[model samples]
Target chain A: MRELSITTEACDTGGCPVRVVRVSGYIDAHSFPRFEREILTLVNQGNNRLLLDLRNATYICSTALGLLMSVFRQVRHNAGDLVIAGMSEKIANIFNLLGISKLIQAFPDEEEALRCLAAAEAS
Target chain B: MTTRRRDLALMVPGEAEYLCLVRDLVTTVARKAGFPDCRIGEIEIAVDEACANIIEHAYGRRPPGEPHVGKPQAIAVRLALFPDRIEVRIRDRGRCFPPEMASSLDIAEFAASGRRRGIGSYIIRSFVDEVHHSYRPGRGNELTLVKYLAKGVPGG
Candidate 1:
Protein backbone atom coordinates (compact mmCIF):
# COMPACT_ATOMS: atom_id res chain seq x y z
CA MET A 1 0.00 0.00 0.00
CA ARG A 2 1.29 3.46 -0.83
CA GLU A 3 1.60 5.69 2.23
CA LEU A 4 0.84 9.38 2.56
CA SER A 5 3.67 11.30 4.18
CA ILE A 6 2.57 13.95 6.70
CA THR A 7 4.95 16.10 8.73
CA THR A 8 3.95 18.63 11.35
CA GLU A 9 6.01 21.39 12.88
CA ALA A 10 5.51 24.40 15.09
CA CYS A 11 5.57 27.60 13.11
CA ASP A 12 7.36 30.62 14.60
CA THR A 13 4.64 33.09 13.90
CA GLY A 14 4.58 36.23 16.06
CA GLY A 15 1.09 35.52 17.44
CA CYS A 16 -0.40 32.23 18.52
CA PRO A 17 1.61 29.08 17.94
CA VAL A 18 0.57 27.65 14.58
CA ARG A 19 1.09 24.03 13.67
CA VAL A 20 1.98 23.59 10.04
CA VAL A 21 1.44 20.21 8.50
CA ARG A 22 2.69 19.36 5.04
CA VAL A 23 0.94 16.55 3.19
CA SER A 24 2.27 14.96 0.06
CA GLY A 25 0.48 12.17 -1.75
CA TYR A 26 -2.76 11.17 -3.38
CA ILE A 27 -5.46 12.39 -0.95
CA ASP A 28 -8.14 10.12 -2.25
CA ALA A 29 -10.31 7.49 -0.58
CA HIS A 30 -7.35 5.11 -0.19
CA SER A 31 -5.01 7.50 1.62
CA PHE A 32 -7.62 9.67 3.35
CA PRO A 33 -7.44 7.73 6.59
CA ARG A 34 -3.80 8.56 7.09
CA PHE A 35 -4.43 12.21 6.40
CA GLU A 36 -7.40 12.27 8.80
CA ARG A 37 -5.36 10.56 11.52
CA GLU A 38 -2.55 13.10 11.37
CA ILE A 39 -4.92 16.05 11.40
CA LEU A 40 -6.93 14.63 14.31
CA THR A 41 -3.77 13.92 16.29
CA LEU A 42 -2.74 17.52 15.91
CA VAL A 43 -6.23 18.81 16.68
CA ASN A 44 -6.45 16.67 19.79
CA GLN A 45 -3.18 18.14 20.94
CA GLY A 46 -4.80 21.58 20.84
CA ASN A 47 -2.85 22.56 17.77
CA ASN A 48 -5.75 24.43 16.31
CA ARG A 49 -3.80 26.75 14.07
CA LEU A 50 -3.45 24.39 11.14
CA LEU A 51 -1.68 25.16 7.90
CA LEU A 52 -2.09 22.37 5.41
CA ASP A 53 0.52 22.53 2.68
CA LEU A 54 -1.03 20.71 -0.25
CA ARG A 55 1.49 21.73 -2.87
CA ASN A 56 2.62 18.15 -3.29
CA ALA A 57 -0.86 16.62 -3.45
CA THR A 58 -1.36 15.14 -6.90
CA TYR A 59 -5.06 14.44 -6.50
CA ILE A 60 -7.97 15.15 -4.16
CA CYS A 61 -11.58 14.01 -4.37
CA SER A 62 -14.85 15.30 -3.00
CA THR A 63 -14.52 12.89 -0.11
CA ALA A 64 -11.17 14.40 0.79
CA LEU A 65 -12.65 17.87 0.54
CA GLY A 66 -15.57 16.82 2.75
CA LEU A 67 -13.16 15.51 5.36
CA LEU A 68 -11.30 18.81 5.39
CA MET A 69 -14.56 20.64 6.03
CA SER A 70 -15.36 18.29 8.88
CA VAL A 71 -11.98 19.05 10.45
CA PHE A 72 -12.53 22.75 9.95
CA ARG A 73 -15.83 22.55 11.79
CA GLN A 74 -14.21 20.65 14.62
CA VAL A 75 -11.48 23.26 15.01
CA ARG A 76 -13.98 26.06 14.83
CA HIS A 77 -16.06 24.50 17.56
CA ASN A 78 -12.97 24.46 19.71
CA ALA A 79 -12.47 28.15 19.03
CA GLY A 80 -9.36 27.51 16.96
CA ASP A 81 -8.36 28.34 13.41
CA LEU A 82 -7.57 26.17 10.41
CA VAL A 83 -5.83 27.38 7.28
CA ILE A 84 -4.62 25.84 4.05
CA ALA A 85 -1.72 26.90 1.92
CA GLY A 86 0.39 26.06 -1.11
CA MET A 87 -2.45 24.33 -2.93
CA SER A 88 -2.07 23.95 -6.69
CA GLU A 89 -4.51 25.77 -8.91
CA LYS A 90 -6.40 22.58 -9.52
CA ILE A 91 -6.73 21.83 -5.83
CA ALA A 92 -7.53 25.44 -5.03
CA ASN A 93 -10.18 25.50 -7.70
CA ILE A 94 -11.71 22.38 -6.28
CA PHE A 95 -11.88 23.97 -2.84
CA ASN A 96 -13.43 27.07 -4.35
CA LEU A 97 -15.96 25.06 -6.32
CA LEU A 98 -16.98 23.26 -3.16
CA GLY A 99 -17.30 26.58 -1.29
CA ILE A 100 -14.70 25.41 1.18
CA SER A 101 -12.69 28.59 0.76
CA LYS A 102 -15.60 30.49 2.26
CA LEU A 103 -15.51 28.29 5.33
CA ILE A 104 -11.74 28.19 5.84
CA GLN A 105 -8.95 30.59 5.05
CA ALA A 106 -6.59 29.62 2.23
CA PHE A 107 -3.32 31.27 1.38
CA PRO A 108 -0.73 31.04 -1.34
CA ASP A 109 2.04 29.82 0.98
CA GLU A 110 2.60 28.50 4.46
CA GLU A 111 4.14 31.67 5.80
CA GLU A 112 1.22 33.79 4.73
CA ALA A 113 -1.33 31.38 6.18
CA LEU A 114 0.52 31.21 9.46
CA ARG A 115 0.83 34.97 9.58
CA CYS A 116 -2.84 35.42 8.86
CA LEU A 117 -3.87 32.93 11.50
CA ALA A 118 -1.62 34.56 14.04
CA ALA A 119 -2.96 37.97 13.17
CA ALA A 120 -6.53 36.76 13.53
CA GLU A 121 -5.80 35.19 16.90
CA ALA A 122 -4.09 38.33 18.12
CA SER A 123 -6.99 40.53 17.13
CA MET B 1 -39.81 -10.88 -7.55
CA THR B 2 -41.10 -10.76 -11.09
CA THR B 3 -41.35 -7.00 -11.15
CA ARG B 4 -39.41 -5.62 -14.05
CA ARG B 5 -37.14 -2.62 -13.57
CA ARG B 6 -34.69 -0.62 -15.65
CA ASP B 7 -30.94 -0.78 -15.37
CA LEU B 8 -28.50 1.81 -16.65
CA ALA B 9 -24.71 1.99 -16.80
CA LEU B 10 -22.57 5.03 -17.40
CA MET B 11 -18.82 5.17 -17.83
CA VAL B 12 -17.59 7.70 -15.32
CA PRO B 13 -14.40 9.40 -16.42
CA GLY B 14 -11.75 10.86 -14.18
CA GLU B 15 -12.97 14.35 -14.80
CA ALA B 16 -14.89 16.04 -11.96
CA GLU B 17 -18.00 16.60 -14.06
CA TYR B 18 -18.77 12.92 -14.00
CA LEU B 19 -19.47 13.24 -10.29
CA CYS B 20 -22.46 15.46 -10.99
CA LEU B 21 -23.74 13.15 -13.69
CA VAL B 22 -23.60 10.21 -11.36
CA ARG B 23 -25.29 12.17 -8.62
CA ASP B 24 -28.09 13.24 -10.93
CA LEU B 25 -28.59 9.74 -12.26
CA VAL B 26 -28.66 8.20 -8.80
CA THR B 27 -31.08 10.82 -7.55
CA THR B 28 -33.35 10.23 -10.47
CA VAL B 29 -33.26 6.49 -9.99
CA ALA B 30 -33.86 6.74 -6.27
CA ARG B 31 -36.76 9.09 -6.81
CA LYS B 32 -38.28 6.83 -9.39
CA ALA B 33 -37.94 3.98 -6.92
CA GLY B 34 -40.27 5.98 -4.61
CA PHE B 35 -37.60 7.43 -2.33
CA PRO B 36 -38.32 10.83 -0.80
CA ASP B 37 -36.18 13.93 -1.17
CA CYS B 38 -33.96 13.39 1.89
CA ARG B 39 -33.54 9.71 1.19
CA ILE B 40 -32.75 10.43 -2.41
CA GLY B 41 -30.17 12.96 -1.30
CA GLU B 42 -28.55 10.42 0.98
CA ILE B 43 -28.40 7.86 -1.81
CA GLU B 44 -26.99 10.44 -4.16
CA ILE B 45 -24.20 11.30 -1.72
CA ALA B 46 -23.39 7.65 -1.24
CA VAL B 47 -23.29 7.01 -4.98
CA ASP B 48 -21.21 10.13 -5.55
CA GLU B 49 -18.72 9.02 -2.95
CA ALA B 50 -18.45 5.62 -4.55
CA CYS B 51 -18.03 7.00 -8.08
CA ALA B 52 -15.54 9.59 -6.85
CA ASN B 53 -13.46 6.84 -5.30
CA ILE B 54 -13.52 4.95 -8.58
CA ILE B 55 -12.46 7.98 -10.58
CA GLU B 56 -9.77 9.21 -8.22
CA HIS B 57 -8.27 6.05 -6.72
CA ALA B 58 -9.20 3.22 -9.06
CA TYR B 59 -8.14 5.13 -12.13
CA GLY B 60 -5.47 7.19 -10.35
CA ARG B 61 -4.75 10.59 -11.93
CA ARG B 62 -4.76 9.49 -15.54
CA PRO B 63 -6.53 11.73 -18.01
CA PRO B 64 -9.31 10.51 -20.28
CA GLY B 65 -7.88 7.87 -22.53
CA GLU B 66 -9.11 5.37 -25.08
CA PRO B 67 -10.36 2.05 -23.78
CA HIS B 68 -7.13 0.14 -23.30
CA VAL B 69 -6.39 -3.55 -22.86
CA GLY B 70 -7.16 -3.61 -19.12
CA LYS B 71 -8.31 -0.06 -18.52
CA PRO B 72 -11.88 0.89 -19.32
CA GLN B 73 -12.68 4.25 -20.82
CA ALA B 74 -15.01 4.95 -17.89
CA ILE B 75 -16.11 3.43 -14.62
CA ALA B 76 -19.37 1.54 -15.07
CA VAL B 77 -22.16 2.31 -12.58
CA ARG B 78 -24.96 -0.21 -12.87
CA LEU B 79 -28.29 0.27 -11.14
CA ALA B 80 -31.00 -2.35 -10.69
CA LEU B 81 -34.31 -1.75 -9.04
CA PHE B 82 -36.27 -4.49 -7.34
CA PRO B 83 -39.79 -4.48 -5.97
CA ASP B 84 -38.59 -3.40 -2.52
CA ARG B 85 -34.91 -2.57 -2.83
CA ILE B 86 -32.36 -1.01 -5.13
CA GLU B 87 -28.99 -2.53 -5.95
CA VAL B 88 -26.18 -0.51 -7.42
CA ARG B 89 -22.95 -2.03 -8.62
CA ILE B 90 -19.86 -0.10 -9.57
CA ARG B 91 -17.37 -1.94 -11.75
CA ASP B 92 -13.91 -0.82 -12.72
CA ARG B 93 -11.17 -2.58 -14.67
CA GLY B 94 -8.44 -0.42 -13.24
CA ARG B 95 -6.48 -1.13 -10.08
CA CYS B 96 -8.16 -3.46 -7.62
CA PHE B 97 -8.50 -2.46 -3.98
CA PRO B 98 -5.98 -4.08 -1.70
CA PRO B 99 -7.49 -5.96 1.23
CA GLU B 100 -4.77 -4.97 3.64
CA MET B 101 -5.23 -1.29 2.90
CA ALA B 102 -9.02 -1.53 3.07
CA SER B 103 -8.89 -3.41 6.37
CA SER B 104 -6.49 -1.01 8.07
CA LEU B 105 -8.99 1.83 8.24
CA ASP B 106 -10.54 2.63 11.64
CA ILE B 107 -14.03 4.04 11.35
CA ALA B 108 -13.98 5.33 14.94
CA GLU B 109 -10.93 7.41 14.19
CA PHE B 110 -12.73 8.90 11.19
CA ALA B 111 -15.79 9.71 13.28
CA ALA B 112 -13.74 11.26 16.06
CA SER B 113 -11.74 13.39 13.71
CA GLY B 114 -14.99 14.63 12.16
CA ARG B 115 -13.13 14.62 8.90
CA ARG B 116 -15.04 13.45 5.90
CA ARG B 117 -11.71 12.89 4.16
CA GLY B 118 -11.51 9.20 3.41
CA ILE B 119 -14.70 7.50 4.55
CA GLY B 120 -16.22 6.79 1.17
CA SER B 121 -16.67 3.11 1.86
CA TYR B 122 -17.87 3.86 5.34
CA ILE B 123 -20.39 6.35 4.03
CA ILE B 124 -21.57 3.80 1.51
CA ARG B 125 -21.95 1.21 4.21
CA SER B 126 -23.84 3.53 6.51
CA PHE B 127 -26.17 4.88 3.86
CA VAL B 128 -26.96 1.54 2.27
CA ASP B 129 -28.37 -1.51 3.93
CA GLU B 130 -25.70 -3.82 2.51
CA VAL B 131 -22.29 -3.37 0.90
CA HIS B 132 -20.11 -6.03 -0.71
CA HIS B 133 -16.86 -6.11 -2.64
CA SER B 134 -15.45 -8.77 -4.95
CA TYR B 135 -12.69 -9.11 -7.48
CA ARG B 136 -12.43 -11.68 -10.20
CA PRO B 137 -8.86 -12.57 -11.18
CA GLY B 138 -9.39 -11.47 -14.76
CA ARG B 139 -12.59 -9.42 -14.46
CA GLY B 140 -11.40 -6.63 -12.14
CA ASN B 141 -13.13 -5.15 -9.03
CA GLU B 142 -16.84 -4.92 -8.28
CA LEU B 143 -18.60 -3.11 -5.47
CA THR B 144 -22.22 -3.98 -4.86
CA LEU B 145 -24.34 -1.70 -2.72
CA VAL B 146 -27.98 -2.28 -1.84
CA LYS B 147 -30.56 -0.08 -0.17
CA TYR B 148 -33.97 -1.34 0.85
CA LEU B 149 -36.98 0.87 0.27
CA ALA B 150 -39.47 -0.01 2.94
CA LYS B 151 -42.84 1.69 3.28
CA GLY B 152 -43.26 4.50 5.83
CA VAL B 153 -39.50 4.85 6.25
CA PRO B 154 -39.95 8.61 5.96
CA GLY B 155 -38.49 8.49 2.44
CA GLY B 156 -39.75 5.34 0.87
Candidate 2:
Protein backbone atom coordinates (compact mmCIF):
# COMPACT_ATOMS: atom_id res chain seq x y z
CA MET A 1 0.00 0.00 0.00
CA ARG A 2 0.97 3.68 0.21
CA GLU A 3 3.34 5.09 2.78
CA LEU A 4 0.64 7.44 4.16
CA SER A 5 -2.75 8.80 3.17
CA ILE A 6 -4.84 11.43 4.99
CA THR A 7 -8.48 12.24 4.18
CA THR A 8 -10.68 14.75 5.92
CA GLU A 9 -14.44 15.17 6.27
CA ALA A 10 -16.50 17.97 7.72
CA CYS A 11 -19.38 17.06 10.00
CA ASP A 12 -21.83 19.10 12.03
CA THR A 13 -23.14 17.33 15.11
CA GLY A 14 -25.49 19.04 17.49
CA GLY A 15 -24.37 22.41 16.15
CA CYS A 16 -20.72 21.49 16.90
CA PRO A 17 -18.29 21.49 14.01
CA VAL A 18 -15.92 18.53 13.83
CA ARG A 19 -13.48 17.38 11.21
CA VAL A 20 -12.75 13.72 10.80
CA VAL A 21 -9.29 12.97 9.45
CA ARG A 22 -8.64 9.37 8.46
CA VAL A 23 -5.01 8.34 8.20
CA SER A 24 -3.63 5.09 6.85
CA GLY A 25 -0.19 3.51 6.62
CA TYR A 26 2.92 4.58 8.52
CA ILE A 27 3.43 8.07 9.94
CA ASP A 28 7.18 8.26 10.33
CA ALA A 29 9.54 11.22 10.01
CA HIS A 30 9.23 11.10 6.24
CA SER A 31 5.48 11.60 6.17
CA PHE A 32 5.10 13.67 9.33
CA PRO A 33 5.66 16.97 7.57
CA ARG A 34 2.67 16.35 5.31
CA PHE A 35 0.59 15.22 8.25
CA GLU A 36 1.51 18.36 10.14
CA ARG A 37 0.77 20.51 7.17
CA GLU A 38 -2.68 19.00 6.65
CA ILE A 39 -3.68 19.46 10.27
CA LEU A 40 -2.37 22.98 10.44
CA THR A 41 -4.19 23.87 7.23
CA LEU A 42 -7.47 22.67 8.67
CA VAL A 43 -6.84 24.43 11.95
CA ASN A 44 -6.02 27.65 10.20
CA GLN A 45 -9.23 27.37 8.25
CA GLY A 46 -11.13 27.22 11.58
CA ASN A 47 -11.75 23.43 11.39
CA ASN A 48 -10.13 22.62 14.70
CA ARG A 49 -12.46 20.17 16.39
CA LEU A 50 -10.59 17.21 14.99
CA LEU A 51 -11.49 13.56 15.35
CA LEU A 52 -8.43 11.73 14.09
CA ASP A 53 -9.32 8.28 12.78
CA LEU A 54 -6.44 5.87 12.91
CA ARG A 55 -8.21 2.60 12.21
CA ASN A 56 -6.19 1.92 9.10
CA ALA A 57 -2.93 3.48 10.22
CA THR A 58 -0.38 0.77 10.89
CA TYR A 59 2.33 2.76 12.65
CA ILE A 60 3.24 6.15 14.16
CA CYS A 61 6.76 7.19 15.04
CA SER A 62 7.53 9.27 18.12
CA THR A 63 8.19 12.44 16.17
CA ALA A 64 4.73 12.16 14.68
CA LEU A 65 3.37 11.68 18.16
CA GLY A 66 5.16 14.81 19.29
CA LEU A 67 3.69 16.71 16.35
CA LEU A 68 0.25 15.44 17.29
CA MET A 69 0.74 16.79 20.77
CA SER A 70 1.92 20.09 19.38
CA VAL A 71 -1.13 20.27 17.16
CA PHE A 72 -3.33 19.31 20.09
CA ARG A 73 -1.93 22.19 22.07
CA GLN A 74 -2.60 24.53 19.19
CA VAL A 75 -6.18 23.31 18.83
CA ARG A 76 -6.76 23.82 22.51
CA HIS A 77 -5.34 27.28 22.22
CA ASN A 78 -7.98 28.03 19.64
CA ALA A 79 -10.73 26.91 22.04
CA GLY A 80 -11.06 23.67 20.07
CA ASP A 81 -10.27 20.04 20.85
CA LEU A 82 -8.70 17.04 19.20
CA VAL A 83 -9.64 13.42 19.86
CA ILE A 84 -8.73 10.06 18.40
CA ALA A 85 -10.84 7.16 17.17
CA GLY A 86 -10.50 3.55 16.00
CA MET A 87 -6.83 3.14 16.85
CA SER A 88 -5.35 -0.32 17.07
CA GLU A 89 -4.50 -1.72 20.49
CA LYS A 90 -0.83 -1.47 19.67
CA ILE A 91 -1.08 2.26 19.05
CA ALA A 92 -3.29 2.65 22.13
CA ASN A 93 -0.73 0.83 24.26
CA ILE A 94 2.04 2.99 22.89
CA PHE A 95 0.09 6.10 23.74
CA ASN A 96 -0.56 4.83 27.25
CA LEU A 97 3.08 3.94 27.74
CA LEU A 98 4.18 7.39 26.59
CA GLY A 99 1.60 9.22 28.76
CA ILE A 100 -0.23 10.52 25.69
CA SER A 101 -3.42 8.69 26.53
CA LYS A 102 -3.89 10.89 29.58
CA LEU A 103 -4.00 14.04 27.50
CA ILE A 104 -6.05 12.77 24.55
CA GLN A 105 -9.23 10.76 24.60
CA ALA A 106 -9.62 7.81 22.26
CA PHE A 107 -12.70 5.84 21.40
CA PRO A 108 -13.25 2.52 19.75
CA ASP A 109 -14.71 4.05 16.58
CA GLU A 110 -15.41 7.31 14.86
CA GLU A 111 -19.13 7.40 15.57
CA GLU A 112 -18.65 7.15 19.33
CA ALA A 113 -15.93 9.74 19.40
CA LEU A 114 -18.00 12.11 17.29
CA ARG A 115 -21.01 11.61 19.52
CA CYS A 116 -19.06 12.23 22.67
CA LEU A 117 -17.32 15.28 21.28
CA ALA A 118 -20.64 16.67 20.15
CA ALA A 119 -22.09 16.09 23.60
CA ALA A 120 -19.11 17.62 25.26
CA GLU A 121 -19.29 20.58 22.97
CA ALA A 122 -23.01 21.00 23.53
CA SER A 123 -22.70 20.92 27.31
CA MET B 1 16.22 -29.99 22.50
CA THR B 2 17.27 -26.37 22.91
CA THR B 3 16.03 -23.67 20.58
CA ARG B 4 18.76 -22.34 18.39
CA ARG B 5 19.62 -18.65 18.79
CA ARG B 6 19.47 -16.52 15.70
CA ASP B 7 21.41 -13.40 14.74
CA LEU B 8 20.10 -11.21 11.93
CA ALA B 9 21.70 -8.18 10.39
CA LEU B 10 20.62 -5.50 7.92
CA MET B 11 22.24 -2.44 6.40
CA VAL B 12 20.07 0.35 5.06
CA PRO B 13 20.81 3.83 3.84
CA GLY B 14 20.28 6.48 6.49
CA GLU B 15 17.18 7.99 4.96
CA ALA B 16 13.59 8.37 6.11
CA GLU B 17 12.17 6.52 3.11
CA TYR B 18 13.78 3.22 4.18
CA LEU B 19 12.48 3.22 7.75
CA CYS B 20 9.53 0.99 6.87
CA LEU B 21 11.87 -1.73 5.68
CA VAL B 22 13.62 -1.67 9.05
CA ARG B 23 10.36 -1.80 10.95
CA ASP B 24 9.08 -4.68 8.84
CA LEU B 25 12.22 -6.71 9.31
CA VAL B 26 12.29 -6.23 13.08
CA THR B 27 8.62 -7.04 13.58
CA THR B 28 8.62 -10.07 11.31
CA VAL B 29 11.62 -11.48 13.16
CA ALA B 30 10.16 -10.64 16.53
CA ARG B 31 6.99 -12.51 15.68
CA LYS B 32 8.93 -15.55 14.55
CA ALA B 33 10.96 -15.36 17.76
CA GLY B 34 7.77 -15.99 19.79
CA PHE B 35 7.25 -12.44 20.97
CA PRO B 36 3.64 -11.61 21.65
CA ASP B 37 1.91 -9.15 19.38
CA CYS B 38 2.15 -6.30 21.85
CA ARG B 39 5.82 -6.99 22.51
CA ILE B 40 6.46 -7.21 18.80
CA GLY B 41 4.83 -3.84 18.35
CA GLU B 42 7.04 -2.38 21.03
CA ILE B 43 10.14 -3.84 19.42
CA GLU B 44 9.10 -2.47 16.05
CA ILE B 45 8.80 1.05 17.47
CA ALA B 46 12.07 0.83 19.38
CA VAL B 47 14.02 -0.30 16.37
CA ASP B 48 12.28 2.21 14.13
CA GLU B 49 13.06 5.01 16.55
CA ALA B 50 16.71 4.04 16.63
CA CYS B 51 17.03 4.07 12.85
CA ALA B 52 14.99 7.26 12.54
CA ASN B 53 17.29 8.87 15.09
CA ILE B 54 20.24 7.80 13.02
CA ILE B 55 18.63 9.38 9.99
CA GLU B 56 17.89 12.66 11.80
CA HIS B 57 20.14 13.29 14.82
CA ALA B 58 23.15 11.38 13.57
CA TYR B 59 23.37 12.07 9.85
CA GLY B 60 21.08 15.09 9.69
CA ARG B 61 23.17 17.14 12.13
CA ARG B 62 26.23 18.06 10.08
CA PRO B 63 28.61 20.91 10.72
CA PRO B 64 28.57 24.05 8.59
CA GLY B 65 31.92 23.37 6.95
CA GLU B 66 31.26 19.65 6.47
CA PRO B 67 32.47 18.53 3.06
CA HIS B 68 30.15 15.57 2.49
CA VAL B 69 26.87 17.47 2.75
CA GLY B 70 24.91 15.13 0.50
CA LYS B 71 27.01 12.01 1.06
CA PRO B 72 24.96 8.92 1.81
CA GLN B 73 25.32 7.25 5.22
CA ALA B 74 24.30 3.75 6.26
CA ILE B 75 22.75 2.32 9.41
CA ALA B 76 23.71 -1.19 10.40
CA VAL B 77 21.15 -3.04 12.52
CA ARG B 78 21.84 -6.36 14.18
CA LEU B 79 19.16 -8.39 15.93
CA ALA B 80 20.15 -11.28 18.18
CA LEU B 81 17.48 -13.56 19.55
CA PHE B 82 18.10 -15.37 22.82
CA PRO B 83 15.94 -17.71 24.86
CA ASP B 84 14.95 -14.96 27.27
CA ARG B 85 15.23 -11.71 25.35
CA ILE B 86 15.93 -9.88 22.09
CA GLU B 87 18.81 -7.49 21.59
CA VAL B 88 19.14 -4.86 18.87
CA ARG B 89 22.34 -3.03 17.96
CA ILE B 90 22.24 -0.14 15.51
CA ARG B 91 25.51 1.36 14.29
CA ASP B 92 26.13 4.48 12.26
CA ARG B 93 29.16 6.50 11.16
CA GLY B 94 27.58 9.83 12.00
CA ARG B 95 27.56 12.17 14.94
CA CYS B 96 26.88 10.59 18.32
CA PHE B 97 23.55 11.39 19.89
CA PRO B 98 23.85 13.27 23.20
CA PRO B 99 23.33 10.88 26.10
CA GLU B 100 22.17 13.65 28.42
CA MET B 101 19.34 14.53 26.02
CA ALA B 102 17.87 11.03 26.00
CA SER B 103 15.39 11.63 28.75
CA SER B 104 11.72 12.26 27.95
CA LEU B 105 9.80 15.33 28.93
CA ASP B 106 6.24 15.18 30.23
CA ILE B 107 4.05 14.75 27.15
CA ALA B 108 1.84 17.68 28.05
CA GLU B 109 4.74 19.96 28.76
CA PHE B 110 6.38 18.79 25.56
CA ALA B 111 3.30 19.58 23.51
CA ALA B 112 2.93 22.98 25.08
CA SER B 113 6.54 23.74 24.26
CA GLY B 114 5.66 23.38 20.53
CA ARG B 115 8.73 21.26 19.88
CA ARG B 116 8.37 18.61 17.18
CA ARG B 117 11.49 16.63 17.98
CA GLY B 118 13.13 14.78 20.94
CA ILE B 119 10.32 12.30 21.61
CA GLY B 120 12.12 9.50 19.77
CA SER B 121 14.49 9.04 22.72
CA TYR B 122 11.53 8.68 25.04
CA ILE B 123 9.86 6.04 22.87
CA ILE B 124 13.09 4.07 22.59
CA ARG B 125 13.54 4.04 26.35
CA SER B 126 9.93 3.27 27.15
CA PHE B 127 9.64 0.33 24.75
CA VAL B 128 12.92 -1.43 25.46
CA ASP B 129 14.11 -2.88 28.76
CA GLU B 130 17.68 -1.69 28.42
CA VAL B 131 19.49 0.84 26.23
CA HIS B 132 23.18 1.60 25.70
CA HIS B 133 24.98 3.97 23.35
CA SER B 134 28.71 3.88 22.64
CA TYR B 135 30.95 5.66 20.17
CA ARG B 136 34.36 4.60 18.87
CA PRO B 137 36.94 6.89 17.32
CA GLY B 138 37.55 4.76 14.24
CA ARG B 139 34.41 2.62 14.22
CA GLY B 140 31.20 4.61 14.71
CA ASN B 141 28.30 5.13 17.12
CA GLU B 142 26.42 2.02 18.20
CA LEU B 143 23.15 1.91 20.11
CA THR B 144 22.15 -1.31 21.87
CA LEU B 145 18.64 -2.05 23.07
CA VAL B 146 17.32 -5.12 24.90
CA LYS B 147 13.80 -6.29 25.65
CA TYR B 148 13.27 -9.32 27.84
CA LEU B 149 10.43 -11.70 27.23
CA ALA B 150 7.92 -12.29 29.95
CA LYS B 151 8.21 -15.43 32.07
CA GLY B 152 7.07 -18.61 30.31
CA VAL B 153 7.16 -17.10 26.85
CA PRO B 154 8.40 -19.70 24.40
CA GLY B 155 11.92 -19.35 23.11
CA GLY B 156 12.55 -18.64 19.47
Q: What DockQ does every candidate get?
A: 0.13, 0.55
Most accurate candidate by DockQ: 2
lDDT of 1: 0.68
Q: Over all chains combined, what TM-score does candidate 1 have?
A: 0.52
lDDT for position B31 in model 1? 86
Off by over 4 Å in 1: A1-123, B62-72, B98-116, B151-156
Q: lDDT per residue, candidate 2, B3-106, as tens digits?
A: 64999999887887778888888888888888887778888988888887777778884342344556578999899988888888899998867433355558
- i-RMS for every candidate (Å) is 10.4, 4.0
- Among the numbered candidates, top TM-score falls to 2
